[model samples]
Target: MSKRVNRVAEQMKKELGDIIFQKVKDPRIGFVTVTDVEVTGDLQNATIFISVLGDDSDKEASLKGLNTAKGFIRAEIGKRIRLRVTPEIEFAFDESIAYGSRIESLLTQVNNESKE
Candidate 1:
């Protein structure tokens, strides 16, 4: 990705996070954190990575709500950022945080076993 694309992606990530938390008032959208955003080279499409703090059902509900609110998000992005065209937004679950936590737990267990 070029510098322009990176900048745009960063801006999108920040603005989208703000919009989702502040603007959207859907009950289904529980605690959602915007992890990252990936934009196409042409800036036509964007994938928004998110982490939801809940169980499987909560994650599913949040994703469904986000997809339903994509249009509003895109419109807000266009209003906030001066781009020729607003990129279509897609929500994806980010499991990296959970994976890291699991790894940390395993490492701690190994260290404790060694001490014992």
Candidate 2:
């Protein structure tokens, strides 16, 4: 990604997080943190990675709420940022945190076994 694309993604990440937390009033979207945003080179599309503090059902519900509120979020983004064409956005669950936690636990287990 070029500097322009990177900047846009970062701005989107900030704006989206604010919009979700402040503007969107969805009950299912509780405890959602926008982890990252990935934008295409052309800036026509964006994938928003999010982390929800709950089980699979909560995550899925949060995604559904985001999808349902996509129009409002995009409109908010357009108003917040000056873009020729607002990139269409999609929500995705960020698994890196969970993956890292799993890896850390496994390492700790191995370390304990080795110590014994």
Candidate 3:
């Protein structure tokens, strides 16, 4: 991604996070955090990675809810950002947080075993 696109993506991530937190009324979208945003070179589509704080079911439901509200979210973005084209929004579940936690758990186990 170009520097310009990167900048715009960062701004959109922040703004979208705020918008979801403040505007979205869906209960299924509990504790959703926008992890990252990747915009296509043409600015026609954006993939939004989000981390949800909950179990598997919660995460699944949140993803579904976000996908359902994609159009509304895109419209909201168009309203807030002064972009010539509002990128189509796509929600993706981000498991990096969970992966990190698993790594931490393994490290802790290794340390405990070594301490014996």
After superposition on all C-alphas, the RMSD of every candidate to the true structure, in Å, is 0.7, 0.7, 0.8
Model with the higher TM-score, candidate 2 or 3: 2
Tens-digit lDDT track of model 2 for 8-71: 9999999988999999998988799999999999999999999999999999999999999999
- Compared with the true structure, all predictions reach lDDT values of 0.95, 0.95, 0.91
Q: Candidate 2 regions off by >4 Å? A: none
Candidate 2, run of 10 with poorest lDDT: 26-35
Tens digit of lDDT per residue, candidate 1, span 38-110? 9999999999999999999999999999988888889999999999999988899999999999999999999
- Alpha-carbon TM-score of each model against the true structure: 0.97, 0.97, 0.96
Report backbone clashes per prediction: 0, 0, 0
Q: Model 3: per-residue lDDT, tens digit, 1-116?
A: 79989988998999999889998888888899999999999888999999999899999999988887788889999998899999988888888989999999999999999999
